[model samples]
Target: MSNRNIKVVRVTKDDYDQVCAITPPGQIYSGTDYLPDYFHMLLDMSNVEAYAAVVDGKFASFFLSFVVDNGRTVVTRAGRTNKEYAGMGLQDVMRRNTIKDRKYDKMAATSGAHVKAILDQIKSGKREKILMMEFRSYITSGDQLKSILNTIGNTTPSSAKPIDAIELGDILTNQQVSCHLFPESRVIVDWVPYRLIKSNAFLIKTIRTTVIGSNLENGTRILTFGNYFNTTAGLVCNIEVYGCIGETLAEHLYLHLRELISHEISGKVIIRCFYRQETKSNFITKLMNRFGLDITEIWGTGLVCTETTPEIYFR
Candidate 1:
């Protein structure tokens, strides 16, 4: 950490062009040649705190902090366009100290910074009930499934069942859970739905470069992704779960979706499930691990952090 004069400023729609021009190609999500509506959503989110770092009168990097409802913290998209700054070791600084000034502890950051800022405020002392932070790594189509299963090694119980798709959304309506957990988790429920689940085919097509040899037999187009609160949410991925059932069905479904997502969206896919009964049959977990899908962080029970480590915490 050099004594470089680095300043952090909130980002606006106007800065979007500069951010896009500078952000490395690797940092950009596929299908979106540039940050689109989702970028706007993250930047304008009411709960997030967005900041751009300026070093030597130029954009060096940016950090997006998000506060969960119960004092959980998250950061996303700490990026630097300057090759000299790319290796400046900002991640550790940002992770351990960036949001320390923000009142929250036990932060849970994600891949999108702008999204993180919205989530950071909720982690304030007022929401100290938050004990753990949760993060997800979307599994992609090309992930090494055999290597992953070999590690976790059938820790899952046979009787465990995939979370009922309906249950995915129902988690939101629970007032008691909502009171204890940060509203940030709501994003999953907000975006994932049967209708929205049906339209992701376009995204899959957009990221074809990463899906070579995926056993993809056909390509399907999404007619429409259903809307929530009048905004698009879920849609179908390139893979369809039709004619498949039970564990094998779950495994293939997850593998296929993981390939499409990981290749197309962000990083590898891993699931963190927090449940009362606590069994490891989540749709993504079981599906991935069943076929040795890929690196996964499955939490059948207990706190979120305990499971993230050694499972899939990037660093």
Candidate 2:
């Protein structure tokens, strides 16, 4: 119960069920069903590392990281603390320990709080700045997609004509998609391959075409990945779209999403968009408003901090 009594250790196969048991529902898009599978997969990978806080020999909090880009980068995939241990600061313990032990040129994480928690640790001298601090936005939807489209009105410019969109599957298979979507300096850790995308956790029911345009040929491309769940509300959807696709393509994607989930589902459609900059965030916010979707939450402020020289912050 006391901070001194708790221990932070590397997660092992024996800890799998315990971790799953403590993972709160709705913390992730696929919910609890995906937790075990995901951690198991990570456990098998040589590049992956996971840590947990154990109190009285029981798992209290955990964090997951992956060594990406051939040892040049590290990404914090996810972290959560048990509701029972909410105020214990277990997350800080695990995070600090992992960053101290893991050496990499760059680091990244997708968090609702952006990276502010980590920034605070760095500022207070609790942790070292291994990489620059960067924030991104995650947006979810509420209203009907069609109404939003009508409100936005014709997003496509007259000079740029719509081309036959590609299948979502094809886009997922393209390895270049990640590089095309994210900034060159940022290290992206959630680029799910096509094979994994088809799995149950990522059970993509309806993947509408990826709209393309002539004028925005070299511009942003929207890549969507999400899963559906049968909750108390019915078949709820969590669609995560990544990229800086402008208004026209955004409207097109939402139209397809609306059409796919319109029938036989009483649950709400939650569309999450991750933006690397404030301009893009504003752009997506406007689109969401037009569609009648309220801005449920915004995470990652798109700020980056870095250390000019490499040094260990934790020992």
Candidate 3:
């Protein structure tokens, strides 16, 4: 291990093939997983920086930093190490090196397996500095998609409207939205963290995400954002649900799924719905059980290390 020199560098177009070649964990998610399909777009995304962990000369791992929440927050995610170098400390080195010089009020990471490590850091000191939030996702195919939508057909809010760039900006900037819809003023669409600001609106649009909302009196009561992309398994549609449960959640879920039919998109489509921790368990049970549709789930933890979080500190 001492002889191996690991260098972390900014990802470039030249690293595309190598980064894609790095073998991802063989563990299958109920959903599709691939690196290459998304790397190309990340290179040109606004305020997003992607890094590669190179062992000697090969791209052995990758990390991404998203500067959002009006530049006060840094969202770090998509960290991966090749199977060949799994046990080595390349990930720690990459985390430490990539954060140098960049300043932020806090750094947040979404983890499926490393949540406990982040929790350990929080336990070492005051817990308020380091915060934890849980999110869950369920992935289903086009057949299930059709079944659920058909079963729950005509049951969604008639007012759920797909907002354009301008309206999306308005919703994100609303104080009520920050407090209720998105906790801690952090807005994550699909799996990426993004600010709710109007300017940040175009960023999600670049990825072709559509924002839909209902019950917008003082603030939105139910909101959902999503987009789809090609993957090794087929086309994957990703949705993030916030501030709604029961029939309302189902309504938004229906709206998102209707995209395939409305657009006349035909293929083997995989739908992955990401929802907040607060969503009631019965909602999911009913959504599937009542309709006899099955949904495969994955759990994730959101570690928000605030500016004052000392033990879990980064930079």
The per-model lDDT (C-alpha) reads: 0.36, 0.50, 0.63
Regions of model 1 farther than 4 Å from truth: 1-3, 26-37, 75-81, 91-100, 110-170, 173-315
Score candidate 2 by TM-score against the native.
Answer: 0.53
RMSD of each: 13.9, 8.1, 4.0
lDDT against true structure, model 1: 0.36
- Per-residue lDDT of model 1, residues 226-254, tens digit only: 11110121121322222112343443333
Residue 295, candidate 3: how far off, in angstroms? 2.6
Task: Assess the local accuracy of residue 313 in candidate 2 as a C-alpha lDDT between 0 and 100.
Answer: 39
- Using lDDT, give the best candidate's number: 3
Q: Which 10 consecutive residues of model 2 have the lowest summed lDDT?
A: 192-201
lDDT of 2: 0.50
